[model samples]
Target chain A: MEIFMKHFIRAVLVLVFLILQSTFCQFIKIWDIMPNLVLAYIISLALTSDDIMYAGGFGFAAGLLWDITWGRVFGVRTLLFMYIAILAYRAGEYVYRKNISVCVIFTLVGAVITESIFFAANFILTHNASFWQSFFRTIVPSAAYTAAFQLVIYNLCLKISKMGKERSSSV
Target chain B: MNFFKSKLFIVLAIVTVIIVAFMILSAAFGFGTGPVSNGLNIITTPVQNGIYGIGKGISSFFEGIGKSGQYKGLYDESQKRVTELEAEVREIDTLKNENDRLRALLDFEEREKDKKLVAAQVAASSPDNWYAEIQLNKGTNSGIRKDNVVYTDNGLVGYVTEVGPTWCKVLTVLDINASVGCVVPRSGDTAVAEGDAELAQNSECSMNYISKDATVIVGDSVETSGLGSIYPAGILIGKISSITPELQGLYNKATIKTSVDFKSLREVVVIVG
Candidate 1:
């Protein structure tokens, strides 16, 4: 029951961030580009949490919800985020996951790769845009913007990760 | 002792196959309004809209405070202008009566009398900037359908792309995938207004495929040609801000400064069929 509660709280947080990503985040756009809040949450959770399956499951659910609510194509973000969670989980093992700088770097790299893949697919299929233009102009700037927010998100997830541990140790 | 044969790798591969299949099915079958989307909409739409309202309220409170002093000065200036506008109103009223009589003689109908409009507030924006789309609070229940034209008091906004039970998504005029048939009213030359990635960054779109010999110029008004069935004719698209020769020199392309301020677009009207 405790484990179920932990996962349930994580799911709720995912939905909250997903909502902010679409609604409140718009008001804070820097030059028409908003930070990827949902991606930052997924990265932070994957880094701080020890359970890979939970990170992957939450990431999948967030991506599926985002696609259904806001994305033009379904399953695109779902696939990308699932792989991103796994990669972040594996990378977190080699480094000190609790370090804020490491968490920020992970978010930066993850956001860049995600945006690049999404833009490339859009360019290849549509042929209506210039790859280099969107890459330098929007994708890079958006990744940096998302990375800047990882500082706050990482701390938040770190607390959640410790919540379960602290209670278990107390018991 | 091989990574390729690991359970993790096998699981990842299976997930990949399943997601790719889902992507293909969604794209081919147009499952935008399928059961999954509908279910999610039912759960999330009200919550999203409520959060948006709260956010807007907080922001407006701060904005109102900041504009209080500015509004005071504007109010004083408006009082002075009101006297001048009162005289102009009397003259305009006389002219309007004369114009009405002339229109009756010519048997002309009002331009906007036929279209029905439904008002909707913007509930949210696209999660990523790759596409310029917004969610409206109204949906199929509000008589919105795919390709229904959206506009503001200022000008044309975009068309509805996907509709749920209580919400719908609109692809704005600045989206790369959006295109509209437009015409330069002064020259009567038809052109296609299309969204460009580079130009959309500046909140602008491109008017392409203008005839080489056409007398199109900057500052000319552009409106829908009514050539497309989606948008009605004479709906204002924007004004041509600049015209430049195409790279191949075969035609000309004009940049349009849309009249609608998409950045602060809080409300819009959907043309209900």
Candidate 2:
């Protein structure tokens, strides 16, 4: 039951990320560029998760939720996010696990991957002749914008992870 | 055999294959009415709206604080202006009614009177350079269907692509996949206005197939020609921002600054045919 509760809480947090990305994040634009809060959340979730399967599971849930609200190319977000989550899990396995800087670096890479896939997928789907143009123009800048917010999000995730660990240890 | 039997390898391989398959499926077939969108939208609409309202309120509150007493004077001016506008609106309504009565008597064709409009509130938006879309609070229940033309007070926004019970999605004019049959009223030169994934980052759209000899100029008004039958004729789409000669000079392509501001758009009206 305790284990189930732990997983359930994590699952619910993914929904919160969806709500924030669609609603609150809309208003928090820097020069008309809104950060991908859900992507940031996914990276953090995957990094903190102990097991690779757990990362994939949570990312799958979060990405699908984002896709539904996004309503653009369905399952595309899921595919991109789960792939990134698993990637982050592999990255964390090799790197030092519980560092603030490490979190930011992983998030930065994850966001870039997510944005690149998003823009690339869009280019292919739309058959835009300016694929390389859009990739260089839109994807790079947007990835940077999304990565900029990783400072606060990564620290916040660290706090939450620590709290969860302390609670589980106490129990 | 060892690699195939490895649990990590198997899982990673499956995930990769799934990702590749999903992308191919999405590119070939669209993401319309997918497995989870409808059920998810139904559950999230109210909560999303509530969050949106709170988000707007908080931002407005902060803005109000930043401006301080300047808003008070503006508010007074706005109130006075509103009263004057209300008076003018009443006079206009009376005149419109008289004109309609005259047109009925003369058996003249009525314009824009038959298009049924379904109102909706924006629930959420995709925030990025990719796939510009808005999720609306009202959907099939409000008579909004697929390909229904969505517009605002200023001009055409886009059309509905997907509809759930209580929510629908609008692919805005800034989306690269959204193409509208457009015309320059000054030259009658027909063209296709599509959302450019590249230019849309700058909040603009691209027009193609415009004749080389056409009188395409900056600031010329573009509107729906009703050629596509999706949007009604004479609805303003945008203004031509620039016209650049493409290679071979067969036709000139232009950029359109869409009249409807997707950045701040909240409420919209969908015309149901």
* Candidate number with greatest TM-score: 1
- lDDT tens readout by residue for model 1, A90-170: 899999888999988999899999888988776667765677778788888888999999878888888777766777799
Evaluate fnat for each of the predicted models and list the values in order. Answer: 0.71, 0.67
Worst 10-residue lDDT window for candidate 2 chain B reads B104-113
Candidate 1 lDDT over residue span B38-69, tens digit each: 77766777787887788778878888688545
Candidate 2 runs further than 4 Å off: A1-3, A71-74, A124-126, A129-136, A162-171, B1-4, B60-111
- Which interface RMSD values do the candidates have, in the order shown? 1.7, 2.5
Q: How high is the DockQ of candidate 1? A: 0.63
Q: How many residue pairs clash in each candidate?
A: 0, 1
Record all residue pairs in model 2 with backbone atoms less than 3 Å apart, i.e. clashing.
B176-B195
DockQ of each: 0.63, 0.57
lDDT of each: 0.83, 0.77
Q: Which candidate has the highest lDDT of all?
A: 1
Q: Candidate 1, which segments miss by more than 4 Å at Cα?
A: B57-111, B247-249
